[model samples]
Target: MTDLPHYTEYDTRLAAYAVIRDDDGRVLLALWNEGDQPRWTLPGGGVELAETVEEGAVREVLEETGYDVRLDGLLGVDSFVFSPAQRSNGSERPLKAVRVVFAATVTGGELTPEVGGTTDEARWFPLDEVRGLPRVSLVDVALGYLAAG
Candidate 1:
């Protein structure tokens, strides 16, 4: 028998996010505090194994921002691959992030910061001011989708 080369195994993370805008042209955002430099991002997170993407989006938003949201429509999908060196956890294998974005509207609940979670605070920012704030690339991606429509 011939010998074969070994291949590294990688992990893929599937997450869901929402782009929520009010009538006042303000967008809802959450502060992702898991890294050394916290940055603003859409209010959502990883999809649980047992839940659908839509259900996960709603659950994450409620958990992070204390808001009940109704997904209006599908925005788009964003995918990125992180090399081992770029991963925060320093895993040997590359990681593929598949994010599902959706257009959402607030149904109820008040703005509240997430407790003991990856996100620390949630707030609304005027669309014009959002460009000046520190934020993750996903924020820009989601905004681009909104602008396209």
Candidate 2:
């Protein structure tokens, strides 16, 4: 849990994880399904009770992206307060979500479209091309850690 926007009693909130593949400075991204528009995002999901944040990240990557990964390091966190118009699943989601982003590696598993959850598609976009694409700035933060390493 890195420095994140606080969400206490303001509204419903949850914690999530973000996993970035260290590509010697490049990154892997996919166009997501659970967004207002098609947005490229890292692999992750909401944290479940009785599970650690890192474990959630691992499970989420496999579930959302069809890849078994191991958490390598903590990149940082992102706390988002979304409007109902932009909420994923199209309901009033948590007022905020503290995303515990991590740097991870592909341990095994084949990438396929079926594993893409609600995503329209799954493909890895390089780091340099990310900013130009329709992606959130949080992706850039994850990329910065990858570049430093």
Indicate which candidate wins on TM-score: 1
Clash statistics: count for each candidate: 0, 0
Q: State TM-scores per candidate.
A: 0.92, 0.76
Candidate 1 residue runs with Cα over 4 Å from true position = 1-8
lDDT of every model, 2 decimals: 0.94, 0.68
Ten contiguous residues with the weakest lDDT in model 1: 1-10
Residue 108, candidate 2: Cα error in Å is 0.4
Model 2 residue pairs with clashes: none
Candidate No. with top lDDT = 1
Per-residue lDDT tens digits for candidate 2, residues 1-149, read 89754655335554555655456655667667655577877777677888888888888777766788877788777676766666656575346667788878888887755343655455676556778988765677667766676
